[model samples]
Target: MPYPPDVERWRELVSAYFAPEDVNKALWVILHESGGNSNAIGDSGSSLGLFQLNINGLGAGLSEQTRFTPSENIRQAAIHVATTNNWTPWGEGALFRGEPFGSLGNKPYPGDKKNEFAEDTVAIPGQPAPPVINLEDIDEEGFELFSPSGENFEGQFDGYTSNLEFAEKRILNLVLEHNLSFDPNQGYGKTTTDELGDPVFTLHEEANMWSEVFFRSEQGLERISALRDSGLTTAGRKSAEAFLDTSILENAAGQKNFDDFRSRIDALAAVENIPIQRATDIASM
Candidate 1:
């Protein structure tokens, strides 16, 4: 596999799927690993493709065949980065993280290495990614968090922690309510959907809404962003990043991993005193 000839596409994806800092860092990581070549293979035969990811460490759902596609390679790399802080698995060190880039692997004490990434990092390989719910299967005519019909998922909103999935869904629904929402005109912001609607956002805007609503606090956002920046994803981080975590192009356990993350969110939200509904700004953005 050659580096994605269309580096910009991958850049946009990274920007869309990851927090602000992560977008640049992920690209920098590839800059070091494959020189951004999607087709680049590692000197070590086991590694292949853009990020030079080893098939062995790729975890569940992905296989050798995925190497040929630049999109999957970048996506998997971002996931791996989100799961674990630092680019160590990709053969880079915490050097670009303001530490020395070289000799990172030779640091000697593997266990002693402090991941030191912010708390928001999210990555759990044992569990599969959330199931990629087919947007086509969902009703587009109108949006509803609850309804007389069970198909509308009336129970998805179980408050801050348990309703993680619902939050993501609602963000999408609200964004789709073009008649009801407007854009963030804030001039600058993180995430890909910064400029969605005049009042409400769509696409990446939906994701930004999820990121904020789940965390429910500035500290929460930073901690989660730190986690994302460092490349680690815990249950809480996953909960916060769920919007970005579930990409349409990838296969997800969909609802499978949602519970674990929600549980984590439950515990943390209790401790943090985060409200079930953080704010309605996303809807009115």
Candidate 2:
């Protein structure tokens, strides 16, 4: 079934969070289970969300708010797939052969000594007797259940793997470009307030600012200290003040202001060779 429009949006959001290869594998499995239709929350009450998660009795791990949101749902679903795939059941099946029993020979003949090969039945030495090998004694090759003769199971498995790889790549690209956060421990769920708590700036942006202010500037520390001390009402100044007070940043409404202040300080330090001691002296004033 085609994904619901809302579900598609959710898929995009999820793709933004994972690697492209992961996205493909996750989406493929989700389609197989739920066809990407959020409404298909199964009659058995076992399936939920896009992946048809079996929430049944499982404690409410996924946030209720995220359970229904397409973006959040997909994100959680992707995480679910990753988690399940990592487990011995799913991971082994995908990584190794699905049927390990087939490696052993077929059943042995009945009444045969364990591990003993079957020999022709013997009657009196004078009379010839039909060979009476035990049915259980036959060591025939075990049945190939997953890949039955004339079946194209290999092709199907290959297709699934390919899809998984594609999804993973797409997801990875999205994450790199958007700075999406992930927590394997959290699995997939709505972005917690804490998860979204960082200043709403990309890592690259933060790194760049840090480099200019601390590395390039001769008096980088001093200038930064001065900026922190400056009673400026600018967004950057406010952010610095907040940073000084809390030592932690959040994605609240004032992040932009704080980020701007951070950038300005970095730029000033880069452009001016303000000595750290001098900046500190100014800050002391």
Candidate 3:
């Protein structure tokens, strides 16, 4: 069977940058680091490309364009690995310390869990296969550490407005009214309504995915800009700044958790000016 196009591309690049003996190992690392997505931007936009390198620190001297390009990104990663003589720059490397390669084959080394990526490899047959790391441990922890949630709204709007409370409320309402919630099941953002025809605000999972999808589109940016220009009491300006910073797009998992969206509607009912029942009715509507 053929390799995934992106995976095959990375394999060739890795082989070019690494020694014949190390090509398999390099391929293993790239698989875990990026799952072969050259455009994969993670670590809240601080990292880019196949290696998810933080060029500002360990990736020092790499230009923005170089970091974003797959070939250049892989080349720089190979250089970084050669210079350090280890994999400390990457999460899996740093987390595992000395055992940067994880388990090598069908068996788990000591405490290491069995890695399925090892099975996923396209072996050359007769040659020693590369060790595919068990990244589940890192993934669970990383998701918790990096997943964006509504709870971390602190400083999100700094320099945009001082009215955090009103701005947040207005933003939530706008998100609901504009049907910005993305449904992956349909590959688009759409308004869902209950039996009464009241709009159903996005669920936490849907909202999180939508944050990533919506912020990547032109419409999302225009909306953010419009909101920002609307007023200090609204979140458009702050959101726009976040949009520009890629905080709302590439790094949305850090700021767009939808639980807050759900709670805010209930809280909005408590506002003395809005009357609880009316607020509830508005949410249902």
Candidate 4:
């Protein structure tokens, strides 16, 4: 059966985190949990979002606003499923244990929305098992994956290290071009001073820290793009963009004005037609 538009979107999100075969199973759990509502709150508001994540327990450290976001909620749920290799966290999991990737269509949701365990056999009696497909082998064409795989799925920081390196090189050039004063006598850049008071400044470290500011702004743009693609509200996209624009000024190369920094880099990138994923990528390059 075809899912409703919103439900299909949630299924796509689940596919982003879980293996292709497991997507249906995960979505089945989602149907019972939140009914495909991204903003659904249950368990007296303690549990929030699509999977009805418990904020006090598994959903700890994430803000309420974040939990309400569909992408994040699905990602967290997928992480739990991957970690335990079982859907044990949610109440629905207890009902369908042992055979994690079994055909969910056969196991209809209990008439009531209540998550109750059934004394049914682990696998459908005498049924053939589902084929095991590795997550990495799946050709996810349209989906923009935030994480590479479910196994040890850390949040994606695709070009962070390279961005830092590029930023450091740029900063070194900037420091040299601008001739920013670093008093060797006072030991300015966190490295030891030579006998002649010539300081060996670890400018790379400074560049690393400074580069993070730009990287964050870049990451914010990526998230905003994802949000737009996901059909998030204009107000939400604007709010996120506004925050990113404002925050970049605080630590971006000691620049007081956000517009100056952003515009300058953007203008240059535009001229060259560089497909920049990170701000520092074009800026430093």
Show the colliding residue pairs in model 4. none
RMSD of 1: 17.9
Preferred candidate (TM-score higher): 1 or 2: 1
Residue-level error in angstroms, candidate 2, position 121:
79
TM-score, per-candidate, Cα-based: 0.35, 0.29, 0.32, 0.40
What lDDT is reached at residue 37 by model 3? Answer: 60
Per residue, candidate 4 scores C-alpha lDDT tens digits across 69-156 of 5656776776666556667566444433323443332222222343222212122224432222232322232112222122212332
Q: Of the candidates numbered 1 and 2, which has the greater lDDT value? A: 1
Mind giving the per-residue lDDT tens digits that candidate 3 earns over 191-245?
6789999986555433333333323332333433544354522243344434544
Better of 2 and 3 by lDDT: 3
The whole-model C-alpha lDDT of candidate 4 against the native structure comes to 0.48
> Which candidate wins on lDDT?
4
Against the hidden true structure, what lDDT does model 1 obtain? 0.43
Positional deviation of 165 in candidate 1, in angstroms? 28
Better of 1 and 3 by TM-score: 1
Candidate 1 Cα deviation (angstroms), residue 197: 56
Query: Model 2: per-residue lDDT, tens digit, 1-285?
Result: 435443343444344434455555555444444454444444544344454444542214553323433434554543444445441212213422212221221111112111112333324334443323232221122211111011222222223333333333333333334444432222111233446575332333322222222221222232235343554324444455345434312211112123333344334434456565533332221
Instruction: Give the range of the ten consecutive residues with the poorest summed lDDT in model 1.
Output: 106-115
lDDT (tens digit, per residue) of candidate 1 on 1-86: 22344333356445534556666666655555555445555554555555666666662355543653454566566666667755
TM-score of 1: 0.35
What is the C-alpha local distance difference test score of each model? 0.43, 0.35, 0.44, 0.48
